[model samples]
Target: MNLQPDARRALGAGLVVIALVAFSNSSAHISDVGQQAAVAAVSSTDTLTQLNQSLISANKDKGVLKEGELLEKAVHRKALMEILAKENPAHFLRYVLNASQISSLPKSVTATVEKRISTEGVIDTYIIDDFEHPEKSHYEYYFKRGANVKSLYLVGDLLVRSNTQALITGYEGDTYVVADNTKGNVTIKANKDIDGGSNEALGVQNTAVILVDFDDSGPRPFTKEQAKNIFFNAQFNKFMKEQSYNKVSFKGDVYGWYRLSGPSMSNGQHVIPVFGNDNSQLNRIILENNIPIGNYGRVIIAINSDFTSSSQVGMTMQYIGGREYFFSSSWISLAGFDILAPFPFTWTDLDFLLAHELGHALGLMHANSWECG
Candidate 1:
């Protein structure tokens, strides 16, 4: 998430740098004039274009960018959108679905649907799919039944993009999308959610944290003790305790530096072998070695590999004999050892990485606050 020159200019001269310096120095003060300048600068289409271009460029260079850098860039992009929408409503509305259009969506169609807006301002629609009973189409019955259901599925949203009023529905890779106004049947292609039980996240959570490396990879830079500290240290533990009001806290054992069979290098570049979305092979190896995975409520797999793509650095799902687990993989170079290292930026630490993915494993979703002002 290297901020391009164009994006820096769009944000007004030196605002990003000043803000970063302030954050690093623990300074809370930002002049009112500076805030006004940022708002004014972001209210133009040129700023939006520059920010969008920066994101595109960042995506192309994701292999070189750390997860924290990517996250910072995303946050910047979202902030720019929020400011622009608030300062220039008429201009912003030209790109996204407006109140009238959002309200006009058929109640029957939206009855069991959940809608979310992306940072790019596109509306994404998700529908619930029941795995136990394939005949059931809507999500209401399961909602009313509480946590009694054995199997439930939540498919990723149907991304709807439009320049005009027409709505079209289709599939974007595994997830569905709507592109035009024609009413049609949606065929679910991806299962984004698999619920073993809704109440699994409550009370004390016992986790099994496994660190893995590809067979051809080097020794893990961090030791088992360092990895254990990430989850059990006072900072993370206190934060979790406060957030859940002491109702939820984790007790976990760290295991591994386990080597999974895979070609660490592909085409002169390092690669991590992942079977589709979840690392089924890693799960299989753990089970085969008699790791007692079923005893814990959650499992966290930290891979010693840096992600080449920006789509996902961590993911969570119910798998491995229908047990809940999350896979978190990010490169932590030797230089990234500083507790407050600024090179990889913030939120790249093993603590943050595990906690973030663990949030997903606990049924939490990414926070979204951008809305039309």
Candidate 2:
């Protein structure tokens, strides 16, 4: 069924509730002797038909079936597992049915998962089922692994030669780094949990806006006044205000066009420090300029350079000495095209990016389409 972004965001917020309901219902049914007999009586074909009917009913009602209610029927659960096994047997056997396999994974892979769990507290795993193509179903694993929010894909038990190649192929976030050695092709990806901050929402967040340039860079894409308008103007401010229901808002001053001391192009491409390095560099620059960073609660660094790729647009670090910061690579090339004008050339574009990165800074997470259903 079709759903808009706002609706999808709402669904994302309720995911924990849905998971709890589904787990509890499943447990109750598994413990019921009578329910087990009923499930056993239904043939696989009949069970599949019933599952399809339930889906059709939900579609007719213009609402998603509560996963708990849908899976509460023992027959439906069996049908789903059977479908999973028949389609994506590898994933079903390794991840779904075999809970113990996590520990038995190759040492490097097990260490990666364990490290994430140690740092992020607990790993939240999601199994997404594609009814139309069960084989296309996959998993999303979130590890509240970063001080600021980070997103990436994790491919486990993959038989590959190098972890670097795996990251180049499977990575899907703005900020990522290869955290482990390539011992047997196990790529472990991790990101911050959707609920990962304390005191993130509650007051007017003071922010610092810095526009950066490189020694070898060309003319700035936008004027300081234009950059100021993007951050402090009504469009972005009002959006955050309404989204937080007036509980949160941003106030900050804009600074920069400060040329850093290095060549803009790195190995024939414009590159900037990433991960904690970017934050450290910006912090140093702010201190050098005597900007009194302590005055702000958040920081936004806008660079007048093209990113290596479009997927590398922006990322946020929710905490740096109790303050938050996000970086936006202003210029980007879309779909392998040459570098175009600075991204967010229009008000709408800037508003969405600001909202999204700020949402991560505020402890919100990515919302996928499958989550809605």
Best by lDDT: 2
Prediction 2 TM-score vs. true: 0.42
Per-residue lDDT of 1-373 in model 1, one digit per residue for the tens? 2223332121222222211221222321213323454467644556556645544454455455454554564455455444443343333333332334334333432232223322111122211222133223121101001111211111222222110011223211112222211223233223223212233444567777677777755667778887777656645455455445454577878887688786667788665433222346765666667777666766555666653211121123324545544432222222233355245434334444444445434543232221111
Candidate 2 local lDDT, residue 135: 32
Span of ten consecutive residues with least summed lDDT in model 2: 157-166
What ranges in model 1 sit over 4 Å off? 1-197, 265-280, 308-348, 370-373
Candidate 2, lDDT over the whole model: 0.41
**98-125 per-residue lDDT for model 2 (tens digits):** 2253333333322222122113221223
Top-TM-score structure, candidate number: 2
For each candidate, give its TM-score against the true structure.
0.41, 0.42
lDDT of 1: 0.40
Q: For model 1, which pairs clash?
A: 158-176, 166-181, 167-180, 167-181, 168-178, 168-179, 168-180
lDDT of 2 at 334: 16
